[model samples]
Target chain A: MPLLDVDYMLGLVPILLRYLPLTLQMAAVGMALALVLACGLAVIRVLRIPGLNAATLLFISFFRGTPLLVQLFLFYYGLPQLLAFLTQINGITATIMGLTLHFSAYMAESIRAAIVGVDRSQTEAALSIGMTNGQLMRRIVLPQATRVAVPTLMNYFIDMIKATSLAFTLGVTELMGATQKEAAGSFLYFEAFITVAIFYWLIVELLAWVQRRLETRLNEAYRR
Target chain B: MIKVEGLIKRFGGQAVLDGIDLAIEQGEIVVIIGPSGTGKSTLLRCLNFLERPDAGRLTIGDLNVDVTRATRADILTARRRTAFVFQNYALFANKTALQNIAEGLIVVNRWPKERAHARAREILERIGLADKADAYPASLSGGQQQRVGIGRAMAAQAEVILFDEPTSSLDPEWVEEVLGLMKRLAAERQTMLVVTHEMSFARDVADRVIFMEGGRIVEQGPPDQLFRAPQDPRTRDFLRQVLATQVALDVPD
Candidate 1:
């Protein structure tokens, strides 16, 4: 009856924490898959490899223009209708598919920009020293581009962690779904949601700490 | 030995290097001095096919390529036999000095990593940057970075080194060290073709000095004759203007 149930919020923390792994698992797997796909798309975009380049651009536009929640529904509901095999995929698989497709589009553009941002002189220097084009990219260009892309890529990863909360909409019992179930049974909606928010906040805070360490390590070469 | 014949390069339909003909014997130091935009840098860049001369022939050691018709293999072979130094050091930002020096050795020459690193260490010591081997380009002084750039060139053991205004971007304080390194390299009878505005370096280090104008070699001779008594009117006028500016800069305010 009170304005807030502090003790109940405290008690729900353990219950909500139980679902943290599911949330993390979704984010980790989705991000890993997205990063790999994004790198491929970025390389295609950078090279402008004939037919594949135009297709990559259209794919990026479609994924980026649509809402993530709508994309999730399409993957879960719409994909099964077109592809018979997809009908067997559970809610978790569909949610992951949605996340991977959505995030990779954004990541592809950022990675391409980072690669283009590398100094032209670096390429010239590599070529002058007898490096093949492939060697130039692998040894000189990408290493420098990695320095430029790390912060942006880490931002996308954090965005990915929060984006996983939307997985519950697909009927996947991730963090948000678990909270919804508990809230419905007890009718302590605010308390349950607040506990879930704290879990997400803690995870993001831990990740931010890791990102700082990674940035410091990458920036070591540039330090005066 | 290196030879370039009828090296022609055009930008926007205007010739930058118009039918250049040059040859250098092994261990000869040839210095090119000309007014800006006269194609001194372009000629050097064309030797390694960096600009892909419109029509020319380049022969270094036993390798020869027609610039207009050179294949990828020809360009790679040409580059392998020659090294270049830029006005801006252009050291790999992500690599340490040692790694930059060793990169060509391992990647281009296909030497084992340990052998490359060992050679890199000797080059670093020779360049007086032994203690900074682990330091990245960003942390080194401009002089030190350019030394590492030169070390990278040295580690290649190319038949000839092309220097394109190597000290032009340096702070005045840093210029002397780079030029001194070049002097030492020249003293060792290394084959080098240098384009620079440093009259003193040309006079002191170059075995032969070439004067270019309008994308052609207007005159060439020993540095004593070229600097002190240039025969061509264009060369004389260009040298007078450059020397006047040099004297003006040297005068205390």
Candidate 2:
């Protein structure tokens, strides 16, 4: 018996590729939702907003301390036991929730670092010109912070794309889920896994290219 | 007109500005000269509530704010009435030169964008940086950036402009251009309170000069009397040291 199945691996590409949209959908929705949630958390952390800040700290610690797979399982299988309304949540919704909460805890710190990294003089200058704290953040501070944040946020996004593979255990037929189904019937696990891995590698490489272009564009004003 | 009475600021247990009282007339250029760490910059920062004095009262025009109990409205009103030019230029790094000048007008005054841009363009022309409108702070030379910083302050058309050692951070070659722009502003009778180590510029432009040491004003007089014949021994010693340094720099290594 041959140790490899090159033809099966080649054929497996098309079958797995069929689930690319679902995989991208999960990552895209999770990334978009997480960005908003993460920015809010980062602001709360930066400002140290009284009682809300303590809760955010606990939320970040809980999400970041646990394994992503376990978090996905908790949302999929665990939450429904406590909350009756959560019982109707499908696997896709649960996976998206897991990704959003998990990644937002990490992204919030990066965003906060970027915001703080902005020079103190920038704040003073904005105030000297009569900017309220709110105006300063929107007009002066956040624009500069975004420049410092884009590269790191793109890194999180690429990680989120790979993390979508965890959605499979929740019974969502994404890229990895489809591969598992194909491998179970054919019993060619090596070919099936390698094809999905190649797809992930290609997606990461493509995003890294986009990241480079984006960083260059965002940093145009800063180039000496 | 601006008046700061019994202004006191502390950091930790130490007072950086200890019971300082000062007054400046409209369009008067008051130059503050002091040894480093003498609270000269802190005094200017306090007027706009940037440093938030622990105790004092700041009266600028009709708005009187007790520094210790200043509300957000008082702080905002004080800031709106005055503008600051920093030693580090502090031009918004993400913005172009034109945007830096226009930002105050748009944000503070709530002027229409076209009107703000038009005014900013005129100021750019006045500063002779009209050609570099699209250049970011990083792309400009230090002198150009400082010029933009001044232009930003100028665009506000505030009641007074506070310059905190605006030339201290510049390369030696760039100092004169900034000072020259300041001189032109002075010539126009603009109200300016400057903290600077440039004695020559202070001597030439200041309507009144103040010498501060250990967070207190030791002496103040017209620039001619202060520089030529200081009344206080402390002021004399400080000037002698400063002039000696300038003389030493004049000679080759």
Candidate 3:
């Protein structure tokens, strides 16, 4: 059992730092797509329209019940076999597709909870004041729901950052993939893994700090 | 001006409002009083289409609001002219008091933000909450939140405002402030329909007082007549019980 080599770990810092932007990009892109899809799904669920709502519920339940890694593999491998169109899609798109679907399902539930958390009487009040359904949702319900949902949604993004490590399984050379390649070439697994871990820690801490600031600002009106 | 004919509302086979008929004239303040679970609040809510009537004809001004037969557009038109205030002061918790007041004006009436804010400020001032305009409902006291609710209704320029136990959730000291505001509104000839347990406030401000029991209007008339000489035995019993409770509280230890 060799003692931990601080010098070797320090030397790998620059190499891992080079891959930082790629990791952040994957997380950022996945989150943006998930947010848009989640918003549509949440609105559908809240409105509870015929046929469309049932379909969305099935989509959400399926994505949420399964494992994200399995979903990623299915999108990257299984879907291409069934659909000739998806065969032409690149690995990055496949990974992003998997990440978006998996996260959007969870995000939809969080948003729906926030929407439901609003007082039922508020909707009645809005209707009594002559607001149409669309007007009520757009002007009253969603703006308030979004504020409540923001902190929870940010937590999902942080989780998605770590989740992007699974993208390496799809042949996308993101942060984790790059680290594996470096580890194999240098035969220094511990150093390479430690360097990547530190990079992720830094990014997660920064995001968590931002989330706190945002929650505070959103709740400024209620603060004494 | 409102007419309700054969109004019937049921929840899961339990009849809440069964075959109620009433006519209210312009510039009249009608206070509805009833025991819990007697459908007084539901009756006020149905007048504004907040709760759709299961069976009946509700005509506010010229629009019909019977869910069984009315067109969607007609129902929406009727709702615009009638606003409802909830017992819990259902002010939008996330918005400031001013934003709550301005929401209907900007969203429903399509007023510009500047114009809506100006009107909201004026209405808040009228409600005696000008100093707390920018505060959120969660930050305000229960009475202040109810005042914001009143201001929100006023800003919508509703022809008729419905109140469901507006002071039920307020403190004893705070109750007078809100009832005072309602009294001032009544004095200015604002058309209002209120469901309340405060017999004194109803007697003081309402043009007509209607007592309900078991989903029917048991007695209705001018406040002095109804309170002094309630025609029905049920009304007399209710008044006697309420007065007994007050008298028991007033006795020294």
Best-performing candidate as measured by DockQ: 2
User: What is candidate 1's local distance difference test score?
Assistant: 0.91
Question: What is the C-alpha lDDT profile of model 1 across B186-243, one tens digit per residue?
Answer: 9999999999999888888999999999999999999877777778888878887898
Give fnat (model 3).
0.80
User: 2 or 3, which is superior by DockQ?
Assistant: 2
What C-alpha lDDT, on a 0 to 100 scale, does residue B221 get in candidate 2? 94
**What TM-score would chain B receive for each of the candidates shown?**
0.96, 0.96, 0.94
List DockQ for all candidates. Answer: 0.76, 0.83, 0.67
TM-score of each: 0.95, 0.95, 0.92
Per-residue alpha-carbon lDDT of candidate 2 for residues B84-190, written as tens digits (9 for 90 to 100): 99999999998999999999999989999999999999999999899999999999999999999999999988899999999999999999999999999999999
Identify the superior model by DockQ, candidate 1 or candidate 3. Answer: 1
Model 3 stretches astray by more than 4 angstroms = A1-18, A47-50, B65-67, B246-253
The whole-model C-alpha lDDT of candidate 3 against the native structure comes to 0.86
Clashing pairs in 1: none
Q: Of the candidates numbered 2 and 3, which has the greater TM-score value?
A: 2
Docking quality (DockQ) of candidate 1: 0.76
Interface RMSD of 3: 1.5
